[model samples]
Target: MADLELTGAEVLGPEGLHRDGLSFRDGVIVAANGGRRVDLSGYLVLPGIVDLHGDGFERHLAPRRGAMKQLDEGLVAAEAELAANGITTAVLAQFISWEGGLRGFDFAAQVFEAIRDTAPGLVTDLRAQLRFETHLLDFYNELPALLREWHVSYVVFNDHLPHERLAAGRQPRRLVGQALKAGRSPEAHYALMQALHAQNGEVPGALKRLCMELKAAGIRMGSHDDHSAAARADWRTRGVDVAEFPETMAAAEAAHAAGDAVIMGAPNVVRGGSHNGNLSALDLISMGMCDALASDYHYPSPRRAALMLVASGVLDLPAAWRLVSAGPAAVLGLHDRGELTPGQRADLVVLDAETKRVAATFVAGRTSYLSGAIASRFIG
Candidate 1:
């Protein structure tokens, strides 16, 4: 709306802090220099955080354990919440699984397309991520068309078939009971998982080829929960530039060795460890091994974890900010935002620096949320 300008705040950058004024016209930053001036006396201006993976919004889409809501309103609420948390660029990690009922790709596709159409009216920019399960070949068979037209951010390869592990009495199937209750009989699920594993041998090769198709169309792709150096190397060879929640120290180091950005979830950092016994992000960051932090299931976790890292002396503020903002924007290949650089996108967060709390957020130069009005919120 306004050609926004603000001054008298600590502008975070890779090099360090600077007392500079920043100005934005339309949605692009027009200036960033100490000489420029406006009026944000006590605010701490930081690049808006970028979330690479989060399914918290899926709660709104499927609330109350089994209840469903209108996708339009649900997504709008998700946008408001994301903006409230100061996430300027959000990747909607929509699941594409073999399950063939509600919450499947067909239903998610319509809703995700609706999000793209309605993004202009929402509080933040919305990007899509096809969370492709290795066992989801049935759903994936139709992916070529969706990937072509959708603003697909990244493709995540997952293989969460605890069915085989569960049936052998090695673990419980509680994790995927929802899918099981949706008429995917345990036997059938096991059969599907077994079939998919066999099919996976063929699919990774096909998916590797599909990566070329996606790249030709400008889509980025990545692998999820890679467990070893060899696994990371394999995906790297397939043109995957991101390693999402790599499970082993060797895998994370390998991903880094191969020049793939390593992304971990903030909830993993904040909760003292990972949910799935993976490498602890705190340890990774201690070793300077982590690149970006996604909101994952808890949107506020990223924002909170960034400050917490500073508070705990794990990272000075600028470095912490990079993990959430510039780091993600760079890894995601969006050179348009994530820094207070001139000509960058004007997605920004204004914080009460003394209090270390977000005061307001602007997405594409628009006032999307006022932290003074939402400081008490615990969710995004």
Candidate 2:
């Protein structure tokens, strides 16, 4: 890539925002200016967003049931959306759950393979995260091998089974639709749920063993939708140090107390609360409980959420922006590409200062996205 000196924009540095020129060459930020200068007087340049978890790519991969089969093309399209939203590094959370169809094992494997194949050609840094349903006991023994084979390093344990309904021998809500989507009869699906529920006693032991194996393999682990302090503590004990969207304040607090990274959905912050009536992400953030903000299922929410926090006085610009950038990079143990500093990867987003919309995004010093009047500055 050609070296370029970006000048006149308000650059967000590690200390704070300043009117300084930023220069990069060979995909790395540099201290000395050596390239052509691009004046960006009306823009604000900040570290590119590092989205720790998101499933919004699902719509791109499969817009509708059986709508798109070219997984590689879908991934490329997804990268465009991510770059437009100012995300440089994104973790696509694919599910390996009993809930079949797109979230099933076969589809997830295809998605992972597609990501691996397509990422090298794409500018956005796309990574895979397997969201494995904990109740899939039969699949536990094979998970470590499967993850390694798929080149997935991040795993999040999820338990979405309606245990209370199952224990009461009642059918879960939307059983018929769920079964149809899974390509199974309603009776078979219900039976499967009951069977999975029955194996609850074996789940904890299985999870412990599985966590140990994954830990040995250097895989990062997290727990999803944790509901209580005890549950969060239990997962932490099992070496799952990241908590994804803990459902209760107690769980979030427990994760924070134990020094685990707590990832809350950025959409929750933008919308002012959880859509399902769970504990509010804004509340957690205000109390210093949140470690980072993820895009979740909305690619644009991370940027919007950080700005909203600043507008509402919950945090200053730097602190709020960190939730979407440096904070997330830290959570994922990424030592690079979250800050606009010398020697860091040249990953940054330029926003219109007046409207705060993404005008351009650069990943590894290459233009991943360019739009509006800013396109002229880069091209000229």
Candidate 3:
């Protein structure tokens, strides 16, 4: 909670970018500039990136196969990565799926407990988001209570099963490998998939009931990898307003038409397209269909993609940066930290102007990550 002032930087606030000084105290931006001044004449100061959906923390949680250990340690490491990448507020997208091991309910419960315990001491404002696989009929009755117990406010529905192939009694690709990872035999895994898919008749009703319950609990819901306009519309009717990475333009258009926030991966933009041959994020942005960009699997992609957009003339600096900041913040209902405005949380990212690299990250007026010559500015 040290008072600090950043001077001579081109700061982006609610009014837009301007050369000015910013001051903060007791974790909030204030009008009165009273603090030790640090000159940053050639830097760009902007609000910290808000990532609405990121699973990059999964690598830190379980770096390799069968290496899962302490959840707190992994969470600490994840926060360091997030801060280093200029993320101030993040929603860790942990899966509560049929897939066992790290993505299953037991591991998710561990993550929930760890996050709840470790969050107060962390600089980054970390929150949990549950990615629920919709076809898990047995868990339909139990998920709402678990989500409430975990204090998770955001939930995204995903149906990752290759239902067509499974229903045909054909083995989905890499079934053995997936089963091995889940600590089960291939036969057991196939049986599980068949049993889950066989309950498809009951899934619709179960999903409707679950969504209604979650909506009543004040939990914001989203649909993932929406493949069709009809699919998006169905989720919309069930109160799943946020569309996370619609795979087709029609799906995205449906979400946009319904006034829902459409999220795409930042890495998709950085890489120029989706790795899985889905809709291109850059193309979506150009069409005015994309609302926000999440880090997805790559923690640094948000900043990289924003700059990429600016360099490519798809958007100017303010507009491009908004994809990583204000856009995601609004989607996630975090109105406090996405802008460097007075009376807001003092979460800012300072970038080296020439290199366009993150030089430092500040969260709630505290220096969370600092490096290079920028580190010399604070003479403590």
Q: State, as a TM-score between 0 and 1, how close model 1 is to the true structure.
A: 0.89
* True lDDT of residue 74, candidate 2: 93
RMSD of each: 4.0, 0.8, 1.1
Q: How many backbone clashes does candidate 2 have?
A: 0
* Cα lDDT tens digits for candidate 2, 276-329: 999899999999989899999999999999999999999999999999999999
Q: Which ten residues in a row have the lowest lDDT in candidate 3?
A: 61-70
lDDT of 2 at 189: 94
Rank order by lDDT, top first? 2, 3, 1
- How would you encode candidate 3's per-residue C-alpha lDDT over 214-237 as one tens digit per residue? 999999999999999999999998
The list of candidate 1 runs beyond 4 A from truth reads 32-38, 66-69, 99-103, 139-141, 163-172, 198-200, 373-380
Per-model TM values vs. the true structure: 0.89, 0.99, 0.98
Global CA lDDT of candidate 2, please? 0.93
Q: Which candidate comes out best when scored by lDDT?
A: 2
Candidate 3: residue 178 lDDT (0-100):
88
| Per-residue C-alpha lDDT of model 1 across residues 291-347, encoded as one tens digit per residue | 999999999998888888988999998899899999999988888888888888889
